[model samples]
Target: MDQHAQRHGARAARSHGTVEPEHGATTAARHPELAPGTSGMKGRARHIPATVSLPIITALAFGCFIIFRTHTAGIKGGPAMLYGLAGAVVSGALGLVVAHFQSTLITETRASAYGALFGCSLGWVYSLGGEAILKSCAFGFTMGAVMFVAALYVFRTHRTREPHGLHRPHKTHHRDDRSHRLPAATH
Candidate 1:
């Protein structure tokens, strides 16, 4: 028999009764903890520095903006620096708290939390430029609403129905049924 026919026959034979494993079966068998749907890294915590990095960076940027705004408003060097440093520390703490709880929140609440954070930060910066408290709050509320709506839109548009990178096509068996056969021609 030709090599192709030999290979096809072998495949058919294997499919008929052989107990060959599907893809990733061996690896999954070796690690029961990583069984089909589970992530292998259960009970492991993420690195602390990596987790805090984004919040720190955001705090630093917020502080720098506050410092610049304070200075432009004719605040003296020491007070401007103090204001900036204080704002940085507060923002950093707030950011860390938000980051910690963000994962546990539902999508809408998480988005609103982020929006509130952003709005508060912006309003604080605005106030540092000598704006009145009422005006600053109104501005912050408006900005927060905008952020919340934008976040909802983005999340809705970009969300996937299934987990990323975890799709597996189902295996289907073919049968040699009479419905699949061609009809005989009449003489």
Candidate 2:
């Protein structure tokens, strides 16, 4: 019976892609890079330098603003160019600041900052679309509040999730039903 149980255990471990060696070290312990969360850490921490990130951010902002000015605002020529340039400059500056502060700030705080920026940008665009100052203010405030709450919730939820790729044993519950057994009938 013991040998049968041992064989079953070994088979289960083999099926699970894990083996308990005699030395009692897990495969992941021997190769930390193969371990759950640590695998991505080294690769993920490779930061984009500010020079490259800024230009990419600026280009994207410029393209978006040019599209907005031409399609939505019906602007053309020098004015559109200037607006696009302005957007590029603003986004570049914002990107630099974000990059600088990213390492220092908590995830929730960074999320809030991004949310507030989005709300402010939306409010500015709304005002440009002929809305009154008070209405724009109210809209921006509402959006900012919503964003703050959403960001907080998202960061909290994301932080609580376990990192994947770890092998964990599943637990099973066993119940004894001896008390509920019926008496054997005589043939």
Candidate 3:
């Protein structure tokens, strides 16, 4: 009947803390700081730290060994082994470089491109027989970029949320679900 009540329907006149939430609705207080607002851009760019770099390099090197070593049939202590070892060493080294320059905020595509650059470098050096310069460079570009962005994306998405006063109380919760959840006997 009153102006305040009419304006807010049934609960407009209620105090800020009194407005209860409806069913299944959570208060803003319960949610983590989300985006689209100021400071919503939580993403940041950074190089892979020392702790991560070594492991990444090691993984790539091991992969190179797996790939090249198994293929060379009986080339014991021969050019094949030498080349495989060399390729692994170079790949590992390039991985380190990729880790060092790995930027986070940069689009993952660009980051992968960066990684591909490093990877292709090794590919070109060892691909002496028939691989063309353009082909190797393209390969390196793709590999470097993919590697850089993938690493960054994984790291960025894995941040453990810190629960620091994140949620806001849902106004409708008190009025809707709670009222219904009451046992019929209690009602």
Candidate 4:
């Protein structure tokens, strides 16, 4: 439990070789000087948070702002803000439903395209005013497919390059084999 043991990543033993609690912390790594985040290339990208979800928050906040703005405009009945609220709520719902399959921006764009298609189908249904089976499926399908394809194409072609700043020379264990060999043969 002393600082030497902590810096050296040494483990105390119970009856078995199982590591003691003191050594189980991250400081016990072989290279104990390296912090968890900066240890290597693998460590950095593993911890990005859900900052991408802020758009949903913005949509809902804008919806609320619109409702207040409309209310102040002498609206006594159904306000124009309901459309904003509907857009915000529906888009958020769609995002939530689709996010399960989307692990990155590229995949999320495809999901958003799907949501757009769904929303258009809903709009087509609404245009019929509660009638049965008259959606503009062709238009929605074409648009959604086009968008998804375009997004994927861009992601594939314009992919970001690997960072060069962190590059390191390849590691090798080869040593002078001649020094370990027998003496030269004498005729």
RMSD of each: 16.9, 16.9, 21.3, 16.2
Over 32-138, each residue of candidate 4 has an lDDT whose tens digit, in order, gives 33665566655544544443454467457645654555455544346445655775676566555554444433444644665574546344433333234445465
lDDT of 2 by residue, 19-55 (tens): 4554354576566566677757663434557546665
Instruction: Please state the error at residue 51 of candidate 3 in Å.
Output: 3.5
Model 4 lDDT, full chain set: 0.53
Best model number under TM-score: 1
Choose the strongest candidate by lDDT: 1
Off by over 4 Å in 3: 1-77, 93-118, 125-129, 160-187
Q: Worst 10-residue stretch by lDDT in candidate 2? A: 160-169
What is the descending TM-score order? 1, 2, 3, 4
Put the candidates in lDDT order, highest first: 1, 2, 3, 4
| Model 3 C-alpha lDDT per residue in residues 55-157, reported as the tens digit of each score | 4667566556634653554444556556656666666666565555544324454356545655765456434434587886766666666677775575446
Model 4 sits at a Cα RMSD from the real structure of 16.2
Q: Give the better candidate number (1 or 3) by lDDT.
A: 1
C-alpha lDDT (0 to 100) for residue 18 of candidate 4: 58
